[model samples]
Target: MAAPIDLELKKAFSELQVKMIDTQQKVKLADLQIDQLTRVQKHAKLTHTEITTLPDNTRLYEGVGRMFILQSKEEINNQLMDKQKTADEKIKELEQKKVYLERSVKEAEDNIREMLLSRRAQ
Candidate 1:
């Protein structure tokens, strides 16, 4: 009886270890994505500032694949704003995912503790 219980506990522990590792990897990925998004947002802000300083008569040609489309300053500003907004949203989503993953890890740890306590009581 004790041998069977011990094997079961060992299996459960290994499974939990695997889950913890997977969660850690996911958290690291989320952190990396957040960092990239922040860098993108910063670059977009710099571009916006430079564009704002340019003269109205200066022609801005936005490259779209094989062609460059002539665009107004307002249009460029709007594009930058959109980029910034999208980056912000993606960062927020990654942060939320990190939080959720952390919460799940905590719960798994608590469950393991309870299981250990119950086994000891038995």
Candidate 2:
């Protein structure tokens, strides 16, 4: 009886450890993606600011596939807005996912602690 219980407990611990590791990895990945998106959004905002400060009639060129194409100020502003919007959306989604992953990890840790306490009591 004791041997079987020990084996089961070990198995459970192994599984929980695996789950925690997986969740941690996922959280790290989400953090990295969020960081990248944030940088992109920041860059877009800065570029938009610079563009706004320029003369209205100043010629502007937008980059496309390693080449610059002449574009109007309005078009460039529109593109920057789009970029910011898209980055915001993606960052929001990743943040939500990170929350979920963190919750799962916390739950798994609690479960492991509960299991240990129960085994000790027994």
Candidate 3:
């Protein structure tokens, strides 16, 4: 009877340990994703600045060429802006998830500690 109870406790603890590890990995991945998104956002802003700073005639050929280039840049800028917004939103979501995972890990640790203390008291 005691052996079975000990085995069950060990299994539960092992499962909790795995979950804690998985949560830590997820948090790390989220951090990397946030960093990547930040870099992409910066790059987009820089490209937008370069496009806006181009001289009137120097950046594009006159006539139809000018209109085409201007239109292309506008479309690309819009797309980049959209991507940045999406990345920002994802980063925010990941941050929230990371916080929740951290809390869960803390709670799990506390539970394990409490269980051990109670076992010792018994």
Best by TM-score: 1
Candidate 1 C-alpha lDDT tens digits along 9-114: 8887898899899999999999999999999999999999999999998899888999999999999999999999999999999999999999998998888888
* Cα lDDT of model 3 by residue, 1-122, tens digit: 56776786798699888988999899899899889988988887887777668754444322355464335555666776887788789888988988999999999888888877877776
Q: What TM-score number comes out for model 2?
A: 0.90
lDDT of 2: 0.92
lDDT of each: 0.93, 0.92, 0.78
Worst 10 residues of 1 by lDDT: 4-13
Clashing pairs in 2: none
Q: Which ten residues in a row have the lowest lDDT in candidate 2?
A: 1-10
Question: Once superposed on the true structure, which residue ranges of model 3 sit more than 4 Å away at CA?
Answer: 1-5, 55-70
What global local distance difference test value does model 1 have? 0.93
Write the number of the candidate with greater lDDT, choosing between 1 and 3.
Answer: 1
In candidate 3, where is summed lDDT lowest over 10 consecutive residues?
A: 57-66
Backbone clash pairs in model 1 (N, Cα, C under 3 Å; residues 3+ apart or in different chains), count: 0
